[model samples]
Target: MAESEEELKNLLMKVKEESAKYGLKRNIKKTKIMATGPITSWQIEGDEMEAVRDFTFLGSMITADGDSSHEIKRRLLLGRRAMTCLDSILRSRDVTLPTKVCIVKAMAFPVVMYGSESWTIKKADRRRIYAFELWCWRRLLRIPWTARRSNASILKEISPECSLEGQIVKLRLQYFGHLMRREDSLEKTLMLGKMEGTRRRGRQRTRWLDSVFWVTSMSLTKLREVVEDRGAWRALVHGVTKSRTRLTTIFTIFKEDMSHILSIYLSANAFQHSVVPVQLVTHKQGFRVTLIEQEHEWGGTSACMEEHGLGIWDAHQNAYAVHRNTAWRDRSLTSWMCSCMPTPLVPPASAMCTEDWCGSP
Candidate 1:
């Protein structure tokens, strides 16, 4: 806690003197020193304390560099151990999926998220958190790695209301909000106060407050004002986390559907003599694009334009379209066909037609 080694020595001596008066002895063997810059050796009563890179304190890993990567890795390892302990319960066929999910939520998640409220999450940390969550789900479902099930598919099956990363987000925001509303204290001062020193050259590392700013998408001043109203702050946190979960689900489904569609179209034997039109269908869950083969009886000529990657011909317009660099936003059948079709293949203005293929134009 001291700014310099001399000050720290003085504070340690004062503590030792005060404790001796109370018939208490400091455990020199249990003491360790960590520094952000250079490591320094310290002696107390002719016993030198150990200097270490990182150590665990109160169930969380503390590193001199202030990076949470090691802490996150340790947490994941602990979570896996917890999962292993519950393997019999999770793998039991008699246990309902809901019951198993409840067990995991109650047991595994807490261990993984023990000290997440203080984590300065980075992109890599987020990925690790997500992977650990999926690992837990796979273990509960007894899904082997050889099954080739995607993370999205597993998440869809689980349909969790909140993801691990989302929970971390909620906790970080809640902690920040709590600190913002508190009176003067050591934690608050350390979080919000500035220290004297010139920062080292190069890019600055992500801080805990930076993670808060990212999750809330609000500047520090605005966050301070909003956090004053506890009700409003809670609502905001809930809404943000909920929206993130919803968007993640939607995007996962969309990506999986797109991949399926691409695989179907890209297969070498996808088309033979007939040209099949893929129909894009929307449902409550997500988009579904089905590629079914059908005979083209009124066709002038059938050409499987595999070079374009995606080929669609309008039966009514008598024109063929090649899908190259086309955006997915254009949903109308005719508009999509015409806009994507090359200049030479585009139908005449008189023959152009607007048709709804995906149920909406």
Candidate 2:
């Protein structure tokens, strides 16, 4: 832990020096330490007395009710409200609500500057994963639409949909804020593009693109070809900026990536029900592939290969073991590297029966 802290301090110091060149200053106190696990809201029962007692206990623990009694009270109030808000959120069909909240909480450092806003975790020990997520959501709720999109990196890592949703929200905010000149509006309209794609096979993954071109060219087949072109990938992201339709189109690609990764389990005929965390790693030097096999009953093995073109059949067999390729394609047939061998390590115990149970991060 000491070595880790020292390493972090050195990394931060380096970042500070680098930022000085751009006249941008970073306050370490405002930075968030990355956390692992997911978040969920527990069902609160036992009526009003139980709620008040729960609130009082949490309030007393975080605050002494002295010189900063008001601050303490405020945190308690915020926690209560977050709990209530979480309850309302639970009523919805979305399971990612807690995770979205966690992202916002993780960004609390920036939101605090907005004033009068605060957050606190009650019964954090009960479920740190969901609690942290809720903390994020509360902070996000308080962020102005325009400013929210500024944290694109954080949004992509946390909730891509919310990040894209925020981009749309920002446009509406700017238009209403009187900051949208006619040219600015036109520019915004033209910028409506999706922010996701598939990695190129024998490359990383593949994503669908070209909705903007489709809209402009009025040709569906041409649009799909252009979007899937590996050479134009970076250019496409720069072109589209504000359209929800474009964003949805991109999200569809993102979902496609998830679907491809998850398909491994379905093909293997292993545990029919399982949630596997997928990671797509790209190296600057060149493409490398390594597969880790786990022994959990509920868990299953995964096979991934880089492919180009949106279609799975277009991928080259050289990218992955021929026996493993199910629905993926490869870009460079000669450059394919397969890491389909199972790891020697053993998997952890069986996962909890409930889908809400978050395994090791």
Candidate 3:
């Protein structure tokens, strides 16, 4: 609160005098000082106060540089410790997956996200946070690192409505809105005010508001206007969080599924003679698989299935039967159509297929 050492000394002397009148004493040994630029030695009543680069206050780390990276790392460590403490419950077969997820959300997530509302998250920090979240889920599922399971698979198994980052966004938006609504306060002043200073050179570091603006895709003026209406602000925050979660889910699915399909196509020695065009159609329910057969020098018939249908190979009939359900039964050549077939045929991969191509039970 003081601008200089002289001002701080005067302020400390006045505080000591006021405390003495109330029969109290300030502990100089416990007192610490941190400056934004450089550390300075300080002595109060012949006792030297400690100078530190960072310190914990109210369960949150306060650094001299005003960066939240250290605090985030600390939180991740705490989260890991919490997971370790609950390893028994998480690993128990008797404990349901839902119960384990609830426990993680209630216990582990809170520990990591304790004071995240004030975080000025960068791309690297966000990545670290998401990785930590995945780690927590993997541990809960008792999945070892050697398993090589995709993050999408894990997310699909758990089916979380919102990601940890999304939750942080929600908290940050709520806090920002709260601060904006206040008429006059120190927090509001500090958040909205800017100090008069010169440039520090090099690329500018991401600020807290900058992260907010990036997430919300709104300018300060427009954000302020929206914040005036509590309902609108809440809706905006919800939309942003929901969109982020949806996009993340979609991207993960696309990445993993595409890679899987490509690996299958490339590894198949049968498809070297023909050109197979695979198309991915996305719908609200899920993803639809489409295979288009193109004629080549060998001469073949073009086969295209209807929209929202999967082309499954019928090994018995040597034809393809279109399955309406998008759920993939397995990743085998017997289930999926062979690209080398001159006459492509799609069939259902399910065991309970009523169609004749699947054969009578």
Candidate 4:
């Protein structure tokens, strides 16, 4: 840590001297030191630079802790502003909701997702992202906060539906995949570069590469493999961001394993008393459940029922469940719904789950 500080100080001092030689002046008052590690304040020349917890550089906000939550929050606020700026058109009956949503996405989504490709996202960050998304959608739909409708109800009217997180993931994965393809480039080396040091107190925050694993559902070894074929990767990303049903299904299966879906399918098949076998298949979009419509002993010609679309968000008693029953079932037949709700922000765990969980920096 001391060595790191000396190196930084030497570089800054050299910069100051170089500025003097060029007849340029250094403003110590405006300049602030934002250290990442244990070394706090340091002297540039004779003036002592005070360490700051947060600072902005080239429009990107950075915290001493190196987490993106603060930046994400700021981006969301900017997105809200963008949405508000177009309030007249979005709320205007002169335009259709589809056009309004397109305008919002084209105009405001970029603001919301600025620099998201580099974010080391945490669950708190996800909650904030979804919260802002919900706010934007609610404004677009003119749904009051006091209304008792759920996300499922609101999703029905959303034309060309998509998700905030899913898009961010797609963008990030695409960016990473691009970089990974250019193995001989300096950017690739710098991006994949690592520094050796024992971490400070608590668990380490998720790095860009670590977060990409969750986004792509690939291990470290396979990251390069997935990026080899740019067309395939692009199609994969498109499938994720282009369809809201696929996005929801991704989140659904991401939360639970395919075994859970298999169990449900098995239970359904057994309950129907059908001799026909049921098969569970996984795809990029989601699970494909295929089963005989009826047993030959109980029916004539062979028939089949398959459920391939996204599931439905159903509320029974007091809890909620996403249903994926076959198309033959009327209630949840191939339904696609968003179960987005405000997830309670919890203190980050010391150990991060290798799957989808992330830690605060």
Q: Write the per-residue lDDT of candidate 2 for residues 119-198, one digit (tens) a residue.
A: 22122321332233334543445443456443323333344232322232233333322322234564334334444776
Query: Could you give candidate 4's per-residue lDDT for residues 1-361 as a string of tens digits?
Result: 2347778777777788899998998888887777777656767658977788898887889897777888998999899999999888987999987888888889989998888888888868876876677688888998999998766456456733457777787788788888888749876886788878877899877887877765455786777776788887886676545432311211222222446532121111011122333222233234332322222122211222122111222221111121222222334323322233222112124312343322111
Question: Residues 68-147, candidate 3, lDDT per residue (tens digit)?
Answer: 99999999999999999999899899999999999999999999989899999877787788889889989988899999
**Candidate that beats the other on TM-score, 2 or 3, i.e. the better one:** 3
User: Relative to the unseen true structure, what is the C-alpha lDDT of residue 305 in candidate 4, on a scale of 0 to 100?
Assistant: 18
Report lDDT (Cα) of residue 323, candidate 1. Answer: 33
Model 1, residue 118: distance off in Å is: 1.0
lDDT of 1 by residue, 50-157 (tens): 888898999999998888999999999999999999999987889899899989989999998999998887878877887798789998899998998866577668
Steric clash pairs (candidate 4): none
On lDDT, the stronger of 3 and 4 is 3
lDDT value for candidate 3?
Answer: 0.67
Per-model TM-score on C-alpha atoms? 0.68, 0.18, 0.69, 0.65
Candidates, ranked, TM-score: 3, 1, 4, 2
Error of 1 at 273 (Å): 39
**Model 3 CA deviation exceeding 4 Å by range:** 246-361
Each candidate's number of clashing pairs is: 0, 37, 6, 0
Best by lDDT: 3
lDDT of model 1, residue 59: 94
